[model samples]
Target: MFVRIVKMSFEPSNIDTFLKNFEIKKNDIRNFEGCRFLELYRDKNTTNIFFTYSYWDTEEALDAYRHSDLFKGIWAQTKPLFNDKPQAWSVDKLESLT
Candidate 1:
């Protein structure tokens, strides 16, 4: 399986708007082809910081999603809210204890 992690830092005033948009779109993302799982995380000390942790079937599958209209739409609403350029990583799962 392939894993994707995205770190996002939003402008203080835009945090709520970001959260609302995320809530509306997350289900569609999770159900997108090749997506196996999706989750959202927030930094304990940084209220404006968030992360998306997801699993995809393969790198190609992830790439397809990135190029999809769903992603374009979500990103259009999301990009303007960021306080910093977003960061992302694609990785292979090394091990899972449980």
Candidate 2:
């Protein structure tokens, strides 16, 4: 499985708006093809900092989602709220303790 993590830092005032958008779109995103899991996390010490954790069947699957209309819409709405360039990483799981 491919594990993807995206760390995003939003302008302080835009954090609530971003979370609202995510709350509205989370289900749709999670239902996308090859999306095995999806979640959002916030830094306890920094409310404007967030991360998205997800799993995909493969890199191709993730790329497909990235190009989907769902992503285009959500991303376009969210992009302007960034306080800095987002960081993303993809990992291949060697083993899982669980």
* Highest-scoring model, lDDT: 1
The TM-score that candidate 1 achieves is 0.97
Question: What pairs collide in candidate 1?
Answer: none
- Model 2 over residues 58-82: C-alpha lDDT tens digits? 8999999999999999999999999
Q: What are the candidates' C-alpha RMSDs?
A: 0.6, 0.9
Q: List runs of model 2 lying over 4 Å from the truth.
A: none
Candidate 2 clashing pairs? none
lDDT for each candidate structure: 0.95, 0.95
TM-score of each model, paired residue for residue:
0.97, 0.95
Residues 1-98, candidate 1: write the lDDT tens digits. 98999999999999999999999999999999999999999999998999999999989989999999999999999999999999999989999898
RMSD of 1: 0.6
